[model samples]
Target chain A: MSGKEALLEVDGLKKHFKVNQGWIASLMESFGSGEPDYVHAVDGVSFELREGETLGLAGESGCGKTTTGMSLVKLHEPTAGDIIYDDQRLSEATDAEIKKFRQNAQMIFQDPFESLNPRMTVYDTVAEPLRIHDIPNETARVQRALEFAELLPAEHYFDQYPHELSGGQRQRVAIARALVLDPDFIVADEPVSMLDVSLRAGVLSLLDRMTDEFGLSVVYISHDLSLLRHMCDRLAIMYMGKIVEKGPTDQIIENPQHPYTQALINAVPVPDPGVGRDRVELQGEVGDVIDIPTGCRFKNRCSEYIGDVCDQVVPPLEQKTEFEQDVACHLYESAAGYDPYEEMSGSPSAAETGDGAESTPADD
Target chain B: MSQLEVEDLEVYYETEEGPAQAVDGVSFELEEGENLGIVGESGCGKTTLAKAIIGILPDAGYINNGSINFKGDDLTEMSGPERRRLKWEEISMIAQSAMNSLDPVYTIREQIVEAIETHRPGTGRVESDEIVTEMFELVGLDPERADDYPHQFSGGMRQRAMIAMALALEPSLMLADEPTTALDVIMQDQILKRMGSIQEEINSSMLVITHDVSVVAETCDRVIVMYAGKIAEEGPVEEIFNRPYHPYTIGLKRAFPNIRKSSQDLLSIAGYPPELVDPPQGCRFAARCPMATDKCREEEPEAHYENGLRSYCHYADEIDTELRPYADDSDTWSQTAAATDGGVEE
Candidate 1:
């Protein structure tokens, strides 16, 4: 349905925000020439959305996937980067062009319970999009969207407010609002993360069908790997405001090149009891995003850190020989000087917990 | 004797509409040093059950019936002070979120030491410090960061601190309510696995409650499936996962996507669980059950034994082997949902 055309091309995207400084500190900044603090929410990310492809931004919490997803919809304007959609540059577009872009792209927020307006009924919630865009036949378009979103029969829900609807129903209504304008693209941030497991599948299948039928490009952002596997064709693994790896979903999961991606894949709890994975426990918490790391963002928690080069030189996103996915790590780079895994490195204490605890069942 | 036992437990919240029966006639037991898990989704009364056991029910809530026994003593019948005396000394609980559980005003050390001192009164400062350090080591936390405030620690560390506080007294019974729910997957694996090791070291009975099936399957010895304030199935973890007899358990197991498997369409349960307010007199899951017969909607099934497992289904033996295969398809559930709509539609 997409005809393999590039709909949105994002290059070197960066989003940074100034940290709140105390009044005294702000006064001191006038005299002191020290650099003011800034949180690099999204340092640099590059990706392309084919006309109808689903690109999954996968990572743990605070990894900046949400910020990147919100940026495309102009929720968090990028401090530096180029955003070109449908051959039109979005970063420096005219007022009319930006307005048109907003119409074509819409966002489905994370929490269904909080995202919807408490006072608005289903009709008002879905119809608001049409009204804002000044679209004709508001009733017909809203009704069609409600039906397309699988809020079946449509009329019963039109009179009901968000509080009356269940979590699944509320999520469906949110989707309808996004689709009311017949948008060409969607940025869904953890669309089903808040819903129950039973309801998750229903909402996912709805999104899947809508994307396929409408030929819509989607930036589906989620920390859940399983959901991404089911929903997306390609995935970009983020770490501290950077896409450390990006490739086909299957290839990335099957043979993840980056250490962080490998850890994430291994960490996903398998539902079955029979399957056993050699668990990799990260050493400590994620580093403070405010104090971004110099080199690879994941190096502090990385198990197989190469050497001083890992601390000195930042690794570019490079495709290694063994993996089909692109990776940014010194281990894959030959210029890193040496392989640490080949030598003795792991602390006996960390290894003791990693190996001994998994096999030794708690019960006698 | 079992370490912990609950029989005919019923808890109700006094709401404006009426008393919301959150936990209704739920019965289960945990053996000495055994790990048990209560699995359910939102509004299934797992946490209410925990609060009942901990004797921490809110002002508006009360236990209408049944007894919670901790080592032969009826906890429900005990006086307020008697129950308070047993709080961390005999039984301990790791609350849902570690960050919220810890007081932000105090250091982690102060909070832990205070808990230890409150129950066990008057351990010398040096001894208390040593014990705190040992507890930190047991949970893989560095003892040097003991003086750091709650904000200084990570999510996993705060959880570990909470565990250290809970385990400070080495209680015979430990209850962890969604201990790893909010943590990242990597952090969850380590924390849970570390908890298993700690449980083994302490040799304490554990009751873990969570919405994730995998958490129970991997950690607990026995599992109980709950729906609409009633037990759906109860058995050993392996048996329950491999051969689920209850329709609710079958639907739940199939709903979650397997990480190892190829990308296939997920099978979701069609309808939500029944509301507890004036719940109907029938199988709580009958409305959503795929093979729900007319009898299922009319009569509540008792726990019937099948190969040592207990299933609350009239046709447990019949559905055990048959419904397992059909549960993979979403259509099977949707069709039944459509078929049983007109009667007790609420």
Candidate 2:
């Protein structure tokens, strides 16, 4: 897909929440000319989602994957930057435009139990989005939504409350509710994390079907890299509110250049008993996001870091290799000059393809 | 001789509907210092079995039938005071959620001290503190953090503290239920590695119950696959993963995704687990089993041992050839897309 086919483009997005340390402390900090504390949730992250392509945003907890997803759909206002949807800048859109944008860009939350209103029946829950969007035929819209969500024969689940359905069924209801407005793009934030392993596949398959049937562009945010690799077409690895690396799913997993990405991949356990892979245990806990250090956000834990270069200058995200691999690490910079693609061409790995190497078809 | 053996264990909870059979006729053994993993889906009676072993089942739950033989002593035959004395002195438990297990009000030191005091009545405060500090170092937690409350610690740290508390009494057996479920990948690895090394140091047997097969593959010596409160397969971890005899075990292994094999599509078991209450008479898994036949519906398969592994299946002998073919063919197991009935029947 070309740039014109891009459904959503997030450019230098940042969401920083002010840390309220009492009125007195706030006043003192303001008067003392000290730096105000802010939780830099999504700090200068940028990516684009092609139409009908499921782009997975993966990171550890508190790494701002959720924050990025929330900001993209306007659940939380961006501190700075722009969200371009269908060639329209959401940041510059009016309230009415934003509302219309919401109708097109829906979200499926993580916890089905908590996300659904207990007081509302499955029918009402699924119909709420339709009602909000003011579809001409409410009943027909609700029925179609339920049908598409695989809550078949709609009447069976129509009268049943959220408490009455199992975890998988409740999630199906959640998906139905999200798809009620026939959204073109959806943000699924850890949708299967809460469900049991047996139930997770069902929900994942459902999402996969929905994406294909609706031709929806999805931002699948999760901590599970393995699951993401299975579902997503392209992936972006996030660390401390930045997209440290982004590329096609197979390329990223087959050969991850970033130290953090490598560590994350190594941590995933192989199912084969004969295959014993080394477990790369990260050195320390993820650092504080409140006052992040300059230069590389992952410098503290990166084993490949080379001293002051990581501490002195913030590395701009430069495209490496002919492949769409973009990385923000000084180590990738050439010694002679700053030929980003030199390191890329030096390696003969399968990941270095500039053009699309269709090794495997999209499985899901 | 087996170090610990549970025979025909039946633990039930008195719910509003009636008695819910949480653990029904479960039997297993663990040798001294051996790591045994009990794998199952949610509500599969694995946790309940762990609780019964540790003598921590709630007041409403009762053991209707079974014999828990630890060493030579029958734990089920012991009196209330005897059982109380046996706890911590012989066996201890680590709950699934560390956040709720640790007392929020007390410091980590105080909690360990309290456990030591209760178990070892004559131990002085200074001696207990020394032991607590030693445990802190053993679990890789900073000794200075002993005085810190549960809230001050991270999730992984809290779990380490719980492990320290369990070790304070120097129990012979440790029952950890999904200890690393809520933790991140790095933390989970650290905690599991610590637990494995600690088990070696103390030379205590462990029973780890978790839903994640990858965890079992990594940390366990022997694994028992449970389904609907019954043992589907039991074998060494390597065998269970490599040459799984039971259909369910094969299905589970196929379903799980691995780092090395990132390209393969993740296979999912089609049907949900059978309900425990009023479960099918013959084989509990017959409903979802691909190789299930009329014989499976009429009579339950008995445990058949072959090559030092046990499996309850009608065609355990055919596992060498037939198992893989059936398991690999995901289409064979896919149930009709009809939505089944919901809610537990009374």
Candidate 3:
């Protein structure tokens, strides 16, 4: 997976939203030397999407998966960091370069119901992208894209409005619109989450075909591990505006290093009833991105909280295992010798469970 | 006798076009302390069936023909006040959308106390507060935060509060409509785990309606697969997961990608469900069933029983030999369009 050329590179990407303080509150805050509040949605996140690779961006809601995807597509402009596509820096790109980048990369939104215009016909929706790019041969391109989406004949659906199509068909129209530009990559944010289970497979298979046949790099964002496992070649797990762990799909799912990743995987309800997974009880819900603590954001809910170290130092994502994945946690000290974490002990729950690794903590 | 016996349940919604047959000729029994899950896609009438049982269907919707016998008393036959009296005390529902269900103005404790006091007016504030605390504890919410408004709590917390409210009076039968649909995987798991423990403690029968089959696979004891507002199959959860006799059940099972397995090809049931207002005069699943024949398109299948598993399909008895061979293949399902076209009279 690493051998392929990088299609899109996101480095230290940060997107923050200002919490609106009323005039009275703003005046009160101005009187004091207090910092203005900002929801640190996507903070210090970095990842690379190789050509022809399908990378799954997975996290619970508000964990910045959607924010990161939006940032990549310039839907949400980043406050910090950089997004480079096809060797051109997006932030510093010329108008022409940016326009070309837009044609190169597209986004398939989560909800098909709201994504497409109700008034626009299927042909018009698919043709809009081509018209915007000022690409010629609009008639042939739109029909071909629809055919590629398996909307069968494409002409049959030319006049049908979004309201006329089913959830699956509407999504296919969304897909055709995304693929009409013939982009190098597309960011699909929970593309099938709204569709029925029966229809999800069809849409997903179309995405699979896009990557395999067209060699299109895709950043597939979803909360479902099951769907991600089937679709993604590599998986990146996010928590509270940062990539906690990212590795090969199988490696991450089978042997997750981060406590948050473990809990997330264990929590997924397996379809097979016979295989009973012991519940990993983490204390609280996801912490607020606003006024985030100095150290690990996940420490409050992390079962494997290893004392003050987790609360004191922000962990950097690095190669924790022999595998290609990188994990961000205080437990896996990147230094060769003199582990500071070895001295401090974990909480009672961590010691009792002690399934994370052999080197976590031992009773003397 | 069973705790809740629903017989020949036929529910319809008065639409602009005509009466939409949301639930048609569905019958099932929920025994004491049994966890029955109704799994299907949107428009399958699982939610409508739940709403009907709980007697909270929308204004347009009504029970066309059915008998909802709860505790030897038919719920459909009861008057407005009589049914209202029975709600929180005996039967409760955990609505699909937790946020919408909880009133934003009232505090969690106040809302719960109101339900308790309304059902049993003699209960004092202190007693009701104690019940609220106990219920909150059972649902894993901090009892101290009971005074907080619905907006003060997170999505998961609000859902827990909803669960706490539903279990406040300790209803004999609990109806949870997609309890964890809006929640994330971790929150969903925690909520489900909490519900399971609470059910064990209270010994209540729960009817869980969800579009996700995996939720049913874990939480439910018996499962009913609904298609086009009709029962396509009914059996134990394990049997439904392992050996689904109905073609719809088979297709539905294959649709879900298992977390345990790697790179499994997900096969979708091609084509949309028939229009509910005027569904075809045959098996509702015939259009999408790969094993569907001309006989299937002409007539509705009778329920075939095999070791407690009841399947509504022509080849239910010979499912293993005939349908199983072609079920897993995506191509088999894709060809269903052509097969159905051949059967359709133009």
Candidate 4:
């Protein structure tokens, strides 16, 4: 699995949206800041999806995980940076190449109810991709896709409209529609978040089995770390449009070095009441992604804030441990020389990690 | 008197076809300052139960039977005006989704102060403002944000403001339905902790209705598992989670992927909850229950009480040795109709 070819490489991806401050508000901000604001949705994100591997992109709301996923599939074009897919640069692709890319890469949205067409029959919905791709034998392909999505028998759902199906069945149709083109890669954004606990396992297992059977590269985006532990082979934690940490799912959960990641894991309620956690409540709201800070985006609420140095320079993602992936916090670097590479061999700066171990009160 | 006692409550909604029995013969008691949780999937009548308790069911909905005894008053027997007077003054409810519940046009201060004015009559705007400010501080919101509208506050903050408004009048019984469902886990934990502290300070009984079993495990002293508009199981939180007696409760426990446990095949219940419109006779869950027999299909079982846990199942006594084994086996429950009906069904 490690030696397998990389199916998708997303390098230095950035997706920023101009804040829609209509007329008067823009005029007011023009008088104050002198420049129109942009929401830094996905700022300088980089990761590769190895063939047949499921990579999870996890973060709180407005953390840009969804934006990052959307950008990769060109739902919203990448504002900057390059996406290389199977020996082809996506942004530079010609019309035919773009068509191939679209056919090859598919996406499953969070809300199946909103994503599926109300008037479209299940057969028509699933067949739309095959017809668009100009694939031969659309009807047979739709049936096969529906079966693969585990909508067993397929015939029963073919004529039914979206409203006639249950939530789980509707989601299966959405999955079937994505699989219709025989996609090489898939971007599933919180695919099972809207599902009930009883039904969620089936959908998860369906996706898991589909990826294995099809050898599909997947980017499974979700905020549920618990679900990610089961679904994803590797995990990347996003904070304010940047990858704060990335590693094996187990390593990240069991030994999360970043303060924000630790807080997230601790905050999730384990199913049993017997297990109590040492909670680290983050101060205030997640800072505005629009007015993202100059230094570490998480530095203001971080328990391991390290004075002027943290406020001055941006921390670079450095591989610290043998098993650990990149960690961007300064706590892993040597303070005296601030040498990240040399400090990687040693333990984290424990004295500094403790100084602000408890959360600081939100100032304003 | 118990803080709140709902005895043999039956609520129904008039649908286009006929009456849909939303809450059927539900009974529960909450002691003073106690916290109770009602856990069920959507349309299981948990929300209807909350609305009935708060006297705010939809126009089509009606409480057909049973007594809602809050303090010394029978809330079900109370007239419309009498119940209106009791609202926010004695029995308040924090509705789900503060974005819609909080008036968009009014500031947090104005909305909460309006609730205060209605209850405390003759209270000046300045005094009400002072009370809201105090509530904002208690809920860890910056006092300055009291002037902000519901749209201005974050989702978590809007929920906090709704809590503040609900608790503004110092109601003895508070009903919060899925208060933290839309929130992220971290925010959910913070809000739950805040609610716990405020509830303690005011010494009010809380009846929280949510589908998240983990939330119930964390917040409630007692738990009720609802299915097909009936209380399937009721017990202390520990007893319910650890030694669940009812098959539905057991299935629910096994259905969710436990983060603490090693990753394995997650247990999935095979069938949808029985449709509430003209629901099945005998045991409503018999269609999905693996341990269910011909006896289960022919006659409904009464609440079998044991070790402070009440299970509406004939085999409640065999939970540990016999029935649990069947519940633990996914093969025992109804599989999705895909195999039987040849495709997915609504």
**Once model 2 is optimally superposed onto the true structure by TM-score, how far is the C-alpha of residue B137 displaced, in angstroms?**
2.3
- Model 3 per-residue lDDT tens digits across residues B1-346: 8999999999999999999999999999999999999999899999999889888899999999989999999999999999999887899999878889999999998999999999998999999999999998898998999999999998899999999999999999999999999999999999999999999999999999999889999999999999998999999999999888898988889899999898787887777788999999889988787777899999999999986899999888788676677776778876775444333221
Candidate 3 residue lDDT tens string, A158-274: 998988887888899999999999998999999999998888888998999999889999999999999999999999999998899998999999988898999999999988878
Model 1 spans with C-alpha error above 4 angstroms? A1-3, A333-364, B337-346
Candidates 1 and 3 compared: the better one by DockQ is: 3
lDDT of 3 at B198: 97
- Give the Cα error of residue A151 in candidate 4, in Å: 1.8
lDDT of each prediction vs. the true structure? 0.83, 0.81, 0.88, 0.83
Lowest-lDDT window of 10 residues in candidate 2 chain B? B337-346
Best first by lDDT, ranked:
3, 1, 4, 2
The per-prediction tally of clashing pairs is 0, 3, 0, 0
Candidate 4 residue-wise lDDT, A156-195, digit = tens? 7799999998888888899999888888889999998888
Identify the runs in model 3 with alpha carbons over 4 angstroms from their true place.
A1-3, A27-33, A321-323, A335-364, B337-346
Q: What is the lDDT of candidate 2?
A: 0.81
Better of 2 and 3 by TM-score: 3
Question: What is model 4's DockQ versus the real complex?
Answer: 0.58
Candidate that scores best on TM-score: 3
Distance (Å) between predicted and true CA of A88, model 4? 2.8
lDDT of 1 by residue, A1-364 (tens): 4577888998878787788898889888989867677777777788888888888999888888998998888877777777898788887799888888899989999999999999999999999978877899988888899888777678777889888888888999999999988888999999998999877877888888877899988899998887788788889999888889999988888788788998999988877776678788777777876766555677788999876556544566656666577777767743334342322244434332322211211110
Candidate 1 per-residue lDDT, tens place, B69-99, comes to 9899999999999999898888899998988
